[model samples]
Target: MKSIVAGLATEHAENGIGPVVLMLHGWGDSLHSFDALVQKLPGFRIVRLDMPGFGNTELPKDTWTVEQYAKFVAEFCKKTGVQPEYVIGHSFGGRVIIKAVSQRFLEPKKIVFIASAGVADRQNVHNMAFTAGAKIGKALLKPFPKSLYLRLRKELYRVTGGDYISAGALQETFLAVIKEDLSSDAAHIDRPALLVWGEDDIVTPVEEGKKIHRLIKGSELKVLSGAGHFVHQQKADEVAKLIQEFFI
Candidate 1:
């Protein structure tokens, strides 16, 4: 139940292995989200953490940017004496890791992003609509929550993944990630990277995975059939198998 105070992370770690593997959960998810993967990975020491305002972890007293969060994660790594040789991040956590890598934080020997979100390209008309909705959402909030906001996110949760996330945290994450354009920075990622996605992913989309593969030379992309936005959860064994294949 111990955690690093990034105002963003609460961690779970098991020591005694060759190197540490820090697992970062997505928004609305706790360290337990990575439970399946950790169980599959008996070869290395594993650490999973709850992100801010998502699970047991509290959001920072001050509103922090993704870059700041990246610094926090890096600082957390430094303090733990873990020296992770590999790192894994899911969804929103994917963005955070990229931000950290861009700033040259905890450079790992290998990195994996499951349904990542660094691509700036939009797929079609529907994506444009989502962008519009996000823009409108940022303008008003804090106390007066409209029905539209709740419905929109609940629908996204239902459609994208099965997790029922808090509207407030979802709104905050949406606002934080929408304006981000990681294309320029992604080109700089030189680590051995793996990008995986569910063919049915609605959140980050398979296109996002494709874009990551394209941007990061030599990176590999694997699209699992019949999987959706919460592919990591829905298809944990498959995802974990790939991670094992990549990490080993």
Candidate 2:
């Protein structure tokens, strides 16, 4: 289904016929990222959307922070009349959920975060260094041909594990989102929460999950073996089973 939320054209999907389970995908992913996981989750109303700047959803004209994304989710739910009983977020989507629920944007009975990002620790420091290096590299390459400069810049981002090259027009927004840590937000969560992490998740990593788990008192953390960043997709059955058990 398509709807206009926060003045942005949004693409979303609704399936099944039970309690609403809103699933938020990670950065660089669409609602389709949960295709396998959704299928495994039966007997629940599943809601997933192409968040602003991703999938078919129109990107915001101005750069947006995680708080803005949380507000957009609240507005989208209001516009769609969706009162999620259980909310699930993966990666970047998890960051939005944490900000939203902590701020009372959307109140779900229980929340689940899968390989969520938002904690700014040692990894963030490395990212800051990478950003600095990129800026210096850009200045040094200004005299080279535009094509060569662009190619080298892309390689630099790849080598440094930066997502800026893939952010496309939302590069500024990406910078804003990653720089803000959500540890305080997680600390404020009083609702029941479940965190799922991939044992081999180098993106957000297992340590980040452990940090969030500690922030949200009583929150349970489950680390799946042999899974990486896209644990929900890679281990759909295991993830779905965990969600089912947690929501129950």
Candidate 3:
């Protein structure tokens, strides 16, 4: 464990030797998310950290945008005294990495995005209607008492029936991060990239990975059958092998 910032210590694991490899896990996940992959990558020095708000790391004092997370990652690299030769990020971690490379905080020779989540998917008809109705409901309830307004909001969530993340600060942070898409960053990244996605993933989806591949020059997309959002965890050995070959 090390203090990447004052009052915040990151829980991390470092092992092996050779070129430096930095691994960032998904939202609601921690450094241990890459345990199996870490064991398989014996030739490189692997550093996997529990990103802020997950695992042993403390949550951010307030909501943070993706760019803030990217800068925090840069600070982490500086504090650890290791510039990554290869960087691997899964889901929300991928958003941070995308921004990092685009902003030139830490230039890695290669990057691996596993079931990344940064693209803003097109809203389906149902979602579009739901959003419209929710807006109308909010305006209609403006004259109601505060308690009544809150009740109607909860009912609106029930009617919309979407899976919202955790409440309060974490949820607010999630909202802040997801609002920004990384298509521009993907287009700007000059480094070789490997995109791994689960064929069956609903969260982030295979389409999003394809979109990222299309934007990144010389990027390769590998779709694993029967895998989900946590594809790296589900197919750790295969993912690790791909990472090794991509870096080579």
Best by lDDT: 2
Q: For residues 1-248, could you state the per-residue lDDT of candidate 1 as single tens digits?
A: 66657544465556446568988877666778787677767778886666666677776655556776678778777766667789898887888888888779878889999888756476234444565654454344324467776666566545432432343545545545545777767788888999889999878888889888888889999999999877888888899899989988
Model 2 over residues 36-104: C-alpha lDDT tens digits? 999999999999999999999999989999999999999999999999999999999999999999999
Q: Model 3 over residues 1-248: C-alpha lDDT tens digits?
A: 65655357777789898999999888878888888888888989998888888888878888889998898888888887889999999998998999999999979999999988776454344445555666687799889899998888778767763443233347667656656767888789998999999999987889889889988989999999978999888998889889888888
- Give candidate 1 regions above 4 Å deviation: 4-11, 123-173
| Model 2 whole-model lDDT (C-alpha atoms) | 0.92
Cα TM-score of candidate 3: 0.87
In the predicted model 1, the residue pairs found to clash are none
Q: TM-score each candidate.
A: 0.80, 0.94, 0.87
Which has the greatest TM-score?
A: 2
Displacement of residue 95 (Cα, Å) in model 2 is 0.7
Q: Is candidate 1 or candidate 3 better by TM-score?
A: 3
Better of 1 and 2 by lDDT: 2
Alpha carbon lDDT of each predicted model: 0.74, 0.92, 0.83
